[model samples]
Target: MALGLFWATVSLVVFLLISTADMLGYLKPKNHFDVDGKTVVVTGGSQGMGRALGKLLAQRGANVVIVARDRQKLEAALKYISAAAKDVEKQRFHYISADVTKSEENIRIVEEVTSWNNGNSPDVVWANAGGAYSELFIDTPVELMRSQMDLNYFAAAYLAHATLRSWLRPASTKQTSEAAAAVAPRHFIITSSVVCFVGLAGYSPYAPAKSALRSLADSLRSEVRLYNGYRRANPSKGPAADVEIHCVTPGTIFSPGLDNENKTKPAVTHILEESDPRQTEDEAATAAIKGLERGGYLITTQWLGSLLRAGMLGGVPRNAVFMDTMKAWLTPVIWLFMQPDLEGKVLRWGEKNEVKLPQ
Candidate 1:
């Protein structure tokens, strides 16, 4: 009798979950990004979204700077941005060659760009330099995981620290009394991976690194707000200020890396295959700019974007409740429970939030 009763309750709960998902339109698609007239810098701008974003920003009348470890790639990116810029004569196009993983190199890049801008720092900095290679946890080497974290998370933190001062500085002192105007000079954009949301067997290294970044963004957002509050209290010497920080998560776009993976990985291996033809570089950039301009907290492609938002905002309601109920309601059958890894198939990335600019 008890066994039949348990089955009845389980079936009822499952039915409710399915019904909820359908009613909420969980599978619907949408686009949410916006960027316009912002002075922007992109790390790892040689190729992929970094290069794509640079061109889009330039076309929108932004002063765009391309930074990468390869001088040739940086030069090439600059050429592309210059060609795409709306008003080539009015826009400022610049490039810097630096390896962001090295702290000193990042510091030098910040200094160089600041000096070149007549000491005024970039308004938006996009830290898009990251790469992930899939490997099993037991097979993964320790150093590889460290390198991933260093490049994806630490490097971004380092660059933000180096540029924070100039980035948050107040408007020009040389301007006439009437011309003096406040400026929100600092805005940071980070390219974090969708792997941050779900876990899989072979995603040990990459997932953790990406997850760490989400935490970093959350912490940084709080710190910036606290600092802004402090400035408001002691306003005598400080300049007017605001800083905005945005973390952009994108779905799999067809890049060289993804292309290579598609060829190597078996087609039947995963339920969610790489996106068809992936988003073109130009398309992804255009989408991203749209997200920034709209001030999106989580910028994403339509399909996967909705899934992530749902997950963050009270996902797994049925599963959470079911497990708890099982433990209490079915204590005798507790041994039958197994932690099932239903890795989410939706591929989405990006989170955006406001932060204070440095003074």
Candidate 2:
């Protein structure tokens, strides 16, 4: 009887494991996220993950548009992306030099893209332009606080709002119900950070802005559905395509940005950060694209990022309901120790360093 009970428990565990894997997309067919023949716009495309995303989309047969402030880098990136095109002769690639941190510029970017796409909005837009400035909260300059928010949160928000408006504009002539229903879905992707979920010290100037992005994505995902329903209800009026909002939480991406951030990053923050294994921008972009293909709403590019996401997933849409729930349930149990350990490390570092800010 005892042996039967143990075997039964083992079988149940195996079944659960299989179901979790299937639910989390390991066993599912990846039929979604098809970008062939689509137009994609990626901001921050001059460098880092944005550049990688553009190159990958080009490889996937997309007409790629890369946006950045540096015309030279944008031109260089365009050549590299254009080279990866699935159809060199047929596919098109372009770059826009714009400062997305300004709301007006974000709006202009959409207009420019619309013109370039023959009065049609790009099929996909990624708000990937952002920066990180690390400092102790008290030590961070007041001016720097606002600048960080501008670069990290408001830039993405500005682009998202502007592009969404363009994507949702009504057709010049009312579309037939059937035509509206048949329209392809448009995606707006936002880039956030794993630190947004589990913040580290010395990221004072940056983490909250990233956290705001995660929050914004959660709200936008639900909000976009209203338009999806609106189109289904009154197909003739407008919004020819359905809208989907996706956010990616990437762990430390090895890029020029990381190198720049390290110059200002604190020793304690560095110590805390070492737990995450670094990934290059290309690897991060690849992982994020895979998650997007799986239709994950709140996606993470690494195991630790996934764990952090599971812990703080309050009312956000789940990638896989059962898997996310189980992981969510398990996270707090691990955090019981993790929380204290992290706090203790901070306390120890503080005591040893006698941290102080200038008066």
Candidate 3:
């Protein structure tokens, strides 16, 4: 007992020291870019989380541009965002109708927005255009699967690529020096679902696409770091062009999309999703924006979502809070014991219902 107590005391002290060191390292000045007067673009901005995000950004005094395929919806979203804007004259709101799933349309959309802004690259580009459908893998049509990937993955990729290319153009070619000055501290946000990490029944098509975003975000983060390094080495270019890439993994959000999803979502899928607290679109957007402002690379909008993220311990970047890391490391261990029971429930449901599996 005495030996065990001695070791426990030593362990506690060591843990405290490590936690303190990590906290200190993480406390360094974070660059939370100001959105005031910055041009911001959001895809699928006509409705749901996209509209919510647009409203919030406009409220922050950003010049908001909302993109969607539906002209009427785009006009409505513009009005919604304009109403929320801080200064009507300065924080302008505009909408463009474009099919984001098409690569060419994404390019044209960026060009159009730049032209409208007098060749100024947007300071922030949010790829919030995505859709989810839940069905048994066999029941999911090939075309539906393809469309989901196109909308959820390709759309975001095209937008990010186009925006980044525009943002990285030579400073001398910018319409004005002020435009070049606005280029650094750029942000690209992707709205990835919690299903990205925590896959469930009837979500095979949707989960993989969202999971692909994790890889995309990780790769971009590394590339951005390298680009920033080069800029830092070349002092003549002024400050380093810091492009921050963030992937927001929100759990169930109550939006128009969710309403549609609920109509077709399988019972098992709903059961699994309902395990986590559902958030309103506004709440999710608020959490996501706050996470981005705090320099979070992987953002979660709810406690359960955060726990699942931490528990997975994927290669994604974390917030680096000591207790959060500890919870993340420990949660998986706890889940290891809990998951079997959860799996058993799923299996029992499948067996009792004789649910068909895809060959």
Candidate 4:
């Protein structure tokens, strides 16, 4: 009897393992582009991850347009990117200081970048400037949520629309109509967070905004593909094959802002500071280049692959991840009754678990 019980348990475990591997394989990311010498624009290009991506792309010979509201920071980032490239004469980089939240400003930035590219629109656009604060729902002001929406969702959408509009427009009258009709390669990239998939506890204002962004990206991907297909079927009337959209979800980065967030909190400060295995800005920059070159649809940190794999299998929409987190947090009693052994199993599974951030 004892032998039978042990073998039964082993069989069950083996079955579960096989099922898990199949799911992970299905969810493995597909790589899509090599961005070398491409005309690319990175919003919030002055600091943090945006600056990191810009510098990395420039190093790989991409013509980088660094966009930010602060001119000084833009100039500083340009110097850093140019220096990273090292061969000053070979490097091609530009800067446009503008606030992306406003439609007019977004249009202006697009125009400025296009002008520098000899009236050719940028081939790649990285909308990486959005973020939100973590505060208790009751204590959080309404404006905070509004601000998050404007910065994270609206700005990214506006930039994409403006870029597509400019791309579809003719370049110049000087060139023959046929010569001017040639289309340039294009990509729209946005920096979304893991919070787009799952919400934890304190991200009330930010998580929903990110969730909206995920939906936008998914919808935009379909729209771009459909539009392109329609044009391909009718070459004379359709859009050129040079336009695409990519959404990137990077896991918790050990950024200066994360450092600052940790420092301000009294009890968790030491642990937060110590927890980080800091990657140099240059290293992060390099990673961005690799991800872009591979044409990654949803770029994530090395640490996030498992959770994302699990997420894909559940057939969970991006927003469903956030909702599940809330349910888990609010119904601990329900969880205990439903999966009495899950806690021990979760703990034993791994030490560095991919925890969901509070929404």
Best by TM-score: 2
Q: TM-score of each candidate?
A: 0.72, 0.94, 0.88, 0.71
RMSD of every prediction: 12.1, 2.6, 4.0, 9.0
Tens digits of per-residue lDDT for model 1, 244-302: 66666666776765664444332222434343224777777776676666455445544
Give candidate 4's TM-score.
Answer: 0.71
Question: Candidate 2's residue-wise lDDT over 125-243, tens digit each?
Answer: 99999889988888888999999999999999999999888877776668788888777789999999988988678898999999999899989888888888887888888686889
Tell me which residue pairs clash in candidate 4: 32-295, 33-293, 33-295, 200-357, 200-358, 201-358, 202-358, 203-358, 203-359, 204-359
Clash number for candidate 3: 0
Error of 4 at 189 (Å): 0.5
Candidate structures ordered by TM-score, highest first:
2, 3, 1, 4
Off by over 4 Å in 1: 1-38, 168-182, 234-236, 260-277, 313-359
Ranking by lDDT: 2, 3, 4, 1
Q: Each model's number of backbone clashes?
A: 21, 0, 0, 10
Q: How many Å off is the CA of 232 in candidate 4?
A: 1.9
What lDDT does the true structure give each of the candidates?
0.64, 0.89, 0.82, 0.66
Off by over 4 Å in 2: 1-17, 20-26
Clash pairs (backbone) in predicted model 3? none
Clash pairs detected, candidate 2: none
Q: Of models 1 and 4, which has the larger TM-score?
A: 1
Cα lDDT for residue 59, candidate 3: 89
Q: Which stretches of candidate 3 lie over 4 Å from their true place?
A: 1-31, 173-184, 235-240, 354-359
